[model samples]
Target: MDGYRGFLGLLVSALLVGFLSVLFTLIWVLHYREGLGWDGSALEFNWHPVLVVTGLVFIQGIAIIVYRLPWTWKCSKLLMKCIHAGLNAVAAILAVISLVAVFDFHNARSIPNMYSLHSWIGLTVVILYILQLLLGFFAFLVPLAPLSLRAFLMPLHIYSGLLIFGIVIASALTGVTEKLFFALTKPAYSTFPPEGVFTNTLGLLILVFGALIFWIVTRPQWKRPKEPNSVLLQPNGGTPEGVEGSMAINFGKADSESNNEAAARKRNLPLDEAGQRSTL
Candidate 1:
């Protein structure tokens, strides 16, 4: 279908670049720096980069585009929302732990916290991310908020999510550069040392990954079709049987119905059946 054109290719490319960025991050910490650890040392600080890239950069990116998956269109929007929120929650947890590692490392060494420009931006982004998560859960996931509120907040929620993801990439880039400058004294960063070159490449990979995610989520045609009460989703989401039976009837007539008839039926249906007729 025209809606799905280039979706698979773009999705695959995003996945490949995302994983590669994660792998390069591991290599930087393990091979180039002092490997991972939990103690309040530079080793513990290594977890900061690893977790940020894995959680904030990679997993959060996946969450942003989860709604765009074509296969999941047959599933309930509620279930998809849960999956999306779950991914964001995990990313948030990792980001918090990464912050703890930084604070611990600094405290142990008597270094000041939130001193650098990168630290200021990173902390602000993390706080904004938590706020976004909480507001989204209440407005969209729970039934407490009215439709008008959800509609009003939807654009803000989307824009803030992408903005946070962009800031995360910026934070990662600046954080790495600051680390190189501090760590590379004998072979200064300006000398284009091996560590500087490698980290610069890592920064480029992160930029590419962020760009792909933004492109995937922003495209209008790639948005998932809305079929909230469809029978196809009931098997996985436990939708009410009555709702399933009614949706089944509509799917049964989909093949025989003319385009106008289908559109009329969709409008008249209780669940707002906006998915493709051929899919039904």
Candidate 2:
């Protein structure tokens, strides 16, 4: 199971890298066009390509949410299998979107609105992909493991989730801005300017909100008695778990006996029936 989870983590991490790479590339391409003062062609109404891929990415996000639901942890084997299938489907969709976006960017003559769609979809893919990976990794590590291991992975998972959320929110805001202002601005000029200050302000506000949420979620929590043992073992230090305490005690006793025996041997002490040191 650990192996399986590790493999899944690697898979999701790879997909995330691909999605982010393509997304950043698309952003750079847009900036390049803007710098060149290029009025790129309008978005085409080709539903066959964009809608199909977007639909898949959207489904992937929904699948991740279903898979990570708390109730799924205690779900039946059949249900677990279904959830696993959902995760795999997400991974598959992400892979397809990443491939299609790369090809579209490479072959296009000018900047396409589909690039914006790709970026948004890629963000959704990465956010959900990461969440699913962390949940799977934690679910595997938390059982039949020492508290120390759980302590190590728990905060990591939480912080990563918060980051994912921020990314998702940014992607959504960017999508809205690109659609409302970039797509409809020219046609709706009777109501507002093509590049309205309001849209930019909204985008900025979205970024600020995302940043605030990141800060809030990542802030340190005050130490409490009922807090889980893992929380205490954070780098800031709190308290260790009971099982960890027991392991420490047992290890200390073993180390003490070994040191005593070594001291006895150095002093040429008498031997016991088992040919071991009698005393130090």
Candidate 3:
């Protein structure tokens, strides 16, 4: 779309890298290591990397940028907020499951847990991610927070989302490196064995994917434009009716109550002009 230059190409590249990262993870586990299982074998351990890469890394990246997609601008803001919260909830579930897989595998083999920097940072990221999800859901999506408070938290929300994403990528890189060191001693990772090369490539793809996501999200020109007459601004929608009233009450201070109601009833509002003001 004409909304932002370079966004389309960058988004396509990010998707390609994200899919490759997941596929390469699967190949590494199935072809090079034991296939997935849940009996507390090394197979069970395979689920950790796959779930983390797929759900935490790839899906979370998508969730972070969903609002920036120009095509989805026509949808209700409340709908987009729900989609965002749902995706993050899914990512949180997968992260917790992956942690369970790791702890279960460790306990079965009598291997110590929470002993590595990766584990420590990973746990912290997951906890913070859940907290962010809950707070954002309550603040913006639920309309409990005033417009001023939502506006105040918006910057922090964006910053924390990106920060959590970067930390997850770093933890994944360390996890894969740790795996290589422990699993490839037979051929010695320095020998450049096939698995070593393959896993290294996977790590690189993940890193590139993370970098692309950061670049796409941080670009000011790529931000989703504000929609003044959105469902979040209307009073007749089903679930969003409450959200609309909250917006009218909190953000409509520049005009009198009657004027706010008059403006809200006008369905002929132009997008270009409406895009100037931000409600959420």
TM-score of each model, in listed order: 0.81, 0.36, 0.82
Candidate 3 per-residue lDDT, tens place, 123-170, comes to: 999999999999999999997976656767989998899999999999
lDDT of each: 0.88, 0.45, 0.88
| Superposition TM-score, candidate 3 onto the true structure | 0.82
Pairs with steric clashes in candidate 1 = none
For 1-280, candidate 2 gives per-residue lDDT tens digits of 2244543453454345334433433343343223212122222212212322233333333343343333344455346646655554555565555445544543564454435664666446565755556565445433444456666676765555555545555564555455455445445624665344444444454444444333332333311113122223342333355446456557779999999999988776444533663443
Location of the lowest summed lDDT over 10 successive residues in candidate 2: 222-231
Ranking by TM-score: 3, 1, 2
Model 3, residue 225: distance off in Å is 0.7
Q: Write the per-residue lDDT of candidate 1 for residues 22-125, one digit (tens) a residue.
A: 99999999999979998898999999999999999999999999998988878777899999999999999999999999999999999999889999999999
Cα-based lDDT at residue 254, candidate 1: 78
